[model samples]
Target chain A: MTVLDIPSGIPAHVDTPAPGDPRLARLSLNQRTTANWDLREAVEGAVAAGLPAIGLWREPVAEVGVDVARRIVDDAGLRVSSLCRGGFFTASDRAERTRAHEDNLRALDEAAGLGTKALVLVPGGLPAGDKDLAGARARAAEAIAALVPAAVVRGVTLGIEPMNPIYAADRGVISTLAQALDIAEQFAPHEVGVVVDTFHLWWEPGVYAQIARAGERIVSYQVCDWITPLPADSLLARGMMGDGHVDFPAFTRAVAAAGYTGDVEVEIFHADVWAAPGDQVIATMARRYVELVQPHL
Target chain B: MTVLDIPSGIPAHVDTPAPGDPRLARLSLNQRTTANWDLREAVEGAVAAGLPAIGLWREPVAEVGVDVARRIVDDAGLRVSSLCRGGFFTASDRAERTRAHEDNLRALDEAAGLGTKALVLVPGGLPAGDKDLAGARARAAEAIAALVPAAVVRGVTLGIEPMNPIYAADRGVISTLAQALDIAEQFAPHEVGVVVDTFHLWWEPGVYAQIARAGERIVSYQVCDWITPLPADSLLARGMMGDGHVDFPAFTRAVAAAGYTGDVEVEIFHADVWAAPGDQVIATMARRYVELVQPHL
Candidate 1:
């Protein structure tokens, strides 16, 4: 079937919402969910799925060139929700740190070029052989502070994504919504903000309170379900909504009450998700969003 | 070789400290570290290794009977550092919750019989298909509250263990030291307190501050390293001290400064650790404790 054809073979359990369902108005298909799709195809697939916006990733955007990638999304009349990521600030070497800062600056420029105000920053993990978690965390904060000016100049907000603590060793040291807010609160809400990803923060006992406190500073709200018996690689542990334990309605309501009025991005990085037909993944994500999340929003 | 013989095959990289090393005065061997050992073997092993204490698990204790397990530790002159666990308090059904409560009361009695003041409480994860995280947590708190009087009568402290968020869905609902403190602080410090397991809590951004706040309420301090490429079974993700990313000296200092002057239990649950000779495991734990943790204390 063509990329535009809705998969007639979607499992019986999944609902195929009609295209342009009003309930899906805020839905944004993050590119990572359709891992096999190139930048153009992901954008077209999202458009075909009636998603109003698409979340871009820097790698795929760079492959086609950011300018062209922007044009493709613009041509499809789809908004760019937010850039996938831009931060690895925990390096100990001054030169490596400098390189990271420069890369993040470029990421800010790319986010601006893509017509998205949010640049998701995954403050990196500990340096190799370094056990100074506190020191690495301090460096992450300092790096974010350093980038605040560049982000503000570009009219982009540095969105601090507090990854799950499981990734604290090698992916992101910022591991909780409270910790993210601690750093983000250092600057004006418009210049720096937090990404409330349900998969990472759902386990937090104080998450709702933190979300409420996030208020207007909640720049991006990302969704995906956290399934258990985590595969050998914990990175692919996320499941489709309704297939896992997240109470999405409550989580979405908390974000809504916090005054975040923006595209709700669905970003999943599971192996099975990547292997699925991109069109089917979009259909599943859209249907899940409508059933599990939209009513609360 | 006899269980008492110190294996000469220990890798050269692992420091083999002298028996009864003064630096290991406060170290306790948690039974799970030597998963193959029975209650009697673990107690005798602790004695042979010159470790002053052993942390008991209910299963092994039950196998030999709590009274016999108590006598074994007493005869070996090894202090019972703490009991392995007691809480699975997140059941949604009334009868299951009652059974869990009854089981915990028996755990308290077991802790008392074993002569350990601390009973580590792993507040359970969500019931299958349950999406209410807050409800699970609340049930956990209520469960703890219900057991407080029984714990007081048994002179056993309920140590709330804030497991890593990775285990929040299946192992424990309590996922942060701060969250554990929120539940523990509701009762008298001696009746209900917290377990600071390095492997579970080292990733928390506010760990140090929470450690200070835990102060006299810190009932047990368990140590283990968190290694990467977590095996498929995240439950076996723990490693020996100094084997992974935890900074034990800093962590030990935080607990020491928090006024927790108790046996520091070495609780590892990795497959490699379990497969090793139990005597060698004890020796390695003692040596690592001396080099990586005891100095700080």
Candidate 2:
């Protein structure tokens, strides 16, 4: 189906799929997908939408207090699919690096409290005014290694997210699945792994092979569509499924073939998607998931 | 130095370094770098700036006619570094594909007449409304194979340009150096090669290794910096050297080590760079090359 077939804004009558809908058995709503919702609202929204799980972000979780956020998700009977982040440790300054490490440790604790094994780590980009890409990447690897013990102690798997290259300069230096695996493989799979986010990796020519190579090292499988005419703020360039050029069936099949049976988190970061009503956004993603991605999974 | 240190607009005194300036001996001003300059103007600009070579774009060459354009450069004692285009053959429509092939053949003839062996090929992106990336890439490979005989006859090498992934959906599907080499390697080194552009490839973790692997198959080396807060139109995201995060010294060293002895073409597409006086832009790029990239080369 073409992107034009997908509806915009809220549908007149949004139907929440049945709680036990087999199609959404492994589907998850990443909090960022509903950026307008607070921690409690996000959890309640996931439950109301009949979603089995919701991915939590540190900032929102911190606002409601980790204990309260955990209790809310538990009370709603929704699983914590993964934590939004924790890893910006490419700082060259010793003090800054220490602060990042401390922050990550706290993130791990929060992830543990949320009862999720996956803690997505966006390896920091190049330091300001620094043109040393290799140096930045080396620091990321070193930082990931340092976090392994803490991650293992908390029963959390650090999911090294390979962001799109457009963000390599200012957001994340790790820009390829192979680069992420190179570091993840250095440790036990349980201690470290990779996040396979289609939006970030769809353009990779060797993505299928890399997915296969990832095997059990795959920690989280995030889904989002890459739309063209990227927004002025590139961070919000993601589109709802079937509303962009991504071949979701092929990508989902590749991740499934890689033996990644973890929660398939739908994490969109589009300005329009954010502006839409949270329930409508959930309804659209769920419907698109069933039509475009879940069948392949 | 930071981007602030780089001068903006027209410099007060733009010196045209002598033709014998060893530091600029290998530098070629790509026509796009001076977007406003026409064929004759660009050729004369190159000569006035004491540049040894100039990269030609098809439209401008067509404006003055290839033969006339060729004579203009020849009379000015400037070499044609490479031709700007030719290759958008990923169309599924048979007629469209046929048209693309005919146009590419014409481009090959233009490159040959211009006395340049390098014909940069930007393999087209996915067909409209198509989500089949692998299918699009397969078509690109088939199209390149189909054009090989003509490229050989024209004594021109098809330099497959792997554009940054951001353009994979609409501009070019070939998004990695390895992917470009994969297609180029099937043919004789002289018949098919790859263009190594810093702006398009600086984020690749394996770029240095890929450049080394390219070896004799490397046809052209293009330079431009990737600036952040990418303009509303991503096409103009390139920055002046030292104004962005790319490490020119390392990139140029890698290309040089790859045994590339061709012109290092400066191909910026930023609005600010395009708005600046052509001579000032040329002068600035030359200075940046000498300070940041020439030493490494």
Candidate 3:
């Protein structure tokens, strides 16, 4: 019923000693990469694979109850690198704004319970039928400001994600790292920070400059490759690490220089990877992480 | 087989007199919006619809022979507003770069031959297996510099399109109007300028500032809406005017304020629109333009 009760098996991959391996200590698999696994299994899978950490989604945390989920991972000696998400606060209606605020408060609590200081925030897209992007962005800033007190109380850093502009209409209105920083700068770095996801920000020519500018405000560094002939469904196009066009070495160097000693989380959202067995997926992810990304770190 | 020989029929839409209407004079339908139509037909269709201008694509012009294409539009009393495209300069290898340069030279010549003063340039994406976006962008700048002399000689203004960041990987590396201006500002506005397409730029927070920054450097003002459930093929997701989330009134006002008095070309790249009758498609586009976009102008 829990990751703590499961027997620890030798990892199929990562055959070398886990405790002493510097590479294994820095790698984290965001649980959505293995969407089929529940919270307990995800914790056990990461631990068994000799991975030091697992990034969590609120859905699984809510399903098992946050306390139980937190205890499960804690007992397995796995850290929750970052909580999956918390912001979608571009609502114009009073009731909707209140609901979003309540949800984010719960999300901050959940992140705190899991002991993951970072809570990723995908600032919501346009309000229904609204073409005023400027207005929507102002609302997002207000929502973030409103939630900051709660976030600070829970000891959670709200990591605002600057999604690719393609998602500007239907997803996040925070469309560039610079824009994220613009909002994040209003609060202290501990209260509000930036999520540097390579898949979203890699296309930007000035991304490196922004990464360096992020400096101590960089809460998390998420990696996934950008391959094309993208899936008909845009959400599933995040390819495995080395399978796409990202310059991982450059990204790692920039983040390292930015003074972020945080765990590097591989948060992929693809259908094929989700369909595979969790262990196989972890093995493949680990191998790719070692070959393609670990050297950069 | 040529649009030149096809009989000119009465347009199904735009029954009103054309000369006195400012909106009709300012409107132009980009040839790709009616992808199935040939050069002569696009010219004839615009003429029949009482539209004063048509945006020409190099392929259609080449199919009819550039001289013939020019004569056909000239005879129909329709102005060639702007040529569809010319840049794909971001190549890593010398041979490929040479090929791209040569092709762009031909494109500049074609724009000149078609009597369109502005040739739209989609400065290309990353080189094959290349993760160096900064390198690709630098190459694009160099390519533009190389091509500007030929452009000036041909009396063609290179209109660099700042495509949506979604296309930054595969189609156009120039992803922001600001970035386009950075490259364009190095040369005279006449030698290098910006193509302000609503579909490509509507999501940017600083677009209004950039548009004002463009000023006389704005060579063309193209319009299309950003609809959702984007075609799996990102290239075809460009919805017709007013069909999606873009604030056309705001976009029209911005360009007008920026002092661009050029034709407002309606350019949609949807599969359904492409599959329909060109005349019917033109009718719907014209209707949408008059209803949603024409008001601001």
Candidate 4:
């Protein structure tokens, strides 16, 4: 049995299960869920809600120096679940690709500093005016392979997140978990893995099989519901869990069966959720995560 | 070598190939490209442009009465390349599914009456408020199996078209050419086949291999460019060929190598294209088809 690698900060009391509440112990609130919350506030918010971990985004971590951000999460007694992002590695131009490599190295340092082993990578979309999807995908795979050594040195697992195919043009090209695993498989699971996000993948057929194939390579399992009449910009329509069409029970169960004993980061990206008070959002996220997803986990 | 299936209506003068124009001979103007044109007008337009065939939609065909529509094309010496669509087999309810089956029966009759051997099928998306994508897909497969008998009797090949993943929720459940081929493989190639549309499938990885895998089961090959910064409603933003990012040369070459010797239907759905004068739209479509796609074919 793979034991859940609990991150840095869980108070002694919280570590001991609270009567029948073992499921809540795995919850992590991704900072972007409350978009307006700064690093300190988000850490405090997760702590107040008894969430064991907090997923950090680069923007928030950078706002307060990385060291300060680390200190804030450490002080609040919350472990970092995973870093928000660290990719855009689909450029053919040598100069542009080198710049991306430089940016990824800094992202690795930030992830290591934040005390999270997982750095979620969103391999970028088509290069400007380039119509060769096959070529772009080839470049992304090469970039990931190239970054593996640097990622390993920092003790950070590069979690390649295969985004929705809808974003295959402007946002990302890795649009299926199988595709992500194909790239991640080239490296040791500890060096490179995948982030299984429900919102981006619910429509995919054979996802459960792919999840099983992901196995130890699943570095993180993020949850967010997919609501329809998708926003004109589908990227911003990720709904709160249980508020949309995703079947949480099936998803959480599949992840658990795959032996993923890690934080269930609730990473919603919706405008309405962003507008709500951070505390309220955290509370709602925690409640829904427990009610809708916890039983299956 | 599979001989190119040239449909009727080539004027004797046009049949004798002009130097360097053998590839353009297979072009079929899908009526939707000139959305303002009725059956008679579309037939006239195709003849005026020296085109041999027209792809008709059921709605416009129904308006003229299928018999009249067939007569119009026949009298104008034009052949019906393929019927627009006839599938929505994702419904879980028995009664709704039965209705879809009935509609498909009528569609087969229309295709037979119009003298087209192919019927394009856009399997419907998720049932209302349902999240079981796997279940919906299974239902679609079953529905296709059930319809095969009727389709066979009418000598109409059902061409299952895999739509873009972006439309997986509300428009179609089959999101890749591989998925469509999986369903099509169960029946004889003449009984069931697949539609290869560049607009709906350009972003897919390994598409060329899938096209080759499609082989003789490729009932129809449709072309429409995928323009980005997609309109609020993406369904209506399909650009004219060469106006978007699709690499037509590669797609056409792959289809040709697969031995698909049938009509290449220009099927743009853009609002701007729809609003243009029918003759002008047909003129532009013919030009783009020749300039951007014919060479590879």
Model 2 interface DockQ: 0.80
lDDT of 2 by residue, A22-109 (tens): 8888889999989989988888888877889989899999898999998999999888999989999998898999999999999999
Q: Could you give candidate 3's per-residue lDDT for residues A117-195 as a string of tens digits?
A: 9999999888878888999999999999999999888899999999988889888998999999999999999999999
Measured by DockQ, the strongest candidate is 2
Residue clash pairs of candidate 4: B9-B77
lDDT of 1 by residue, B203-296 (tens): 9887999999999998889999988867678988998887789999999999999988899999998877788889878877777787788889
Instruction: Order candidates by DockQ, high to low.
Output: 2, 1, 3, 4
> Over 4 Å off in model 1, which ranges?
A1-14, B1-14
Model 3 Cα lDDT, one tens digit per residue, B149-252:
99999999999999998888888989999999999999999999999999899988799999999999999989888888678888888887655789998888
A-chain TM-score of every model: 0.95, 0.95, 0.92, 0.92
DockQ of each: 0.79, 0.80, 0.65, 0.46
Colliding residue pairs in candidate 2: none
Model 1 has an lDDT value of 0.88
Regions more than 4 Å wrong, model 4? A1-23, B1-23
The alpha-carbon root-mean-square deviation between model 4 and the true structure, to one decimal in Å, is 7.6
Question: Candidate 3: lDDT over CA atoms?
Answer: 0.85
lDDT score, residue A224, model 1? 91
| DockQ of model 1 vs. true complex | 0.79
lDDT tens string, model 4, A153-217?
A: 99999999998877887778888998899888888999999999998788777899999999999
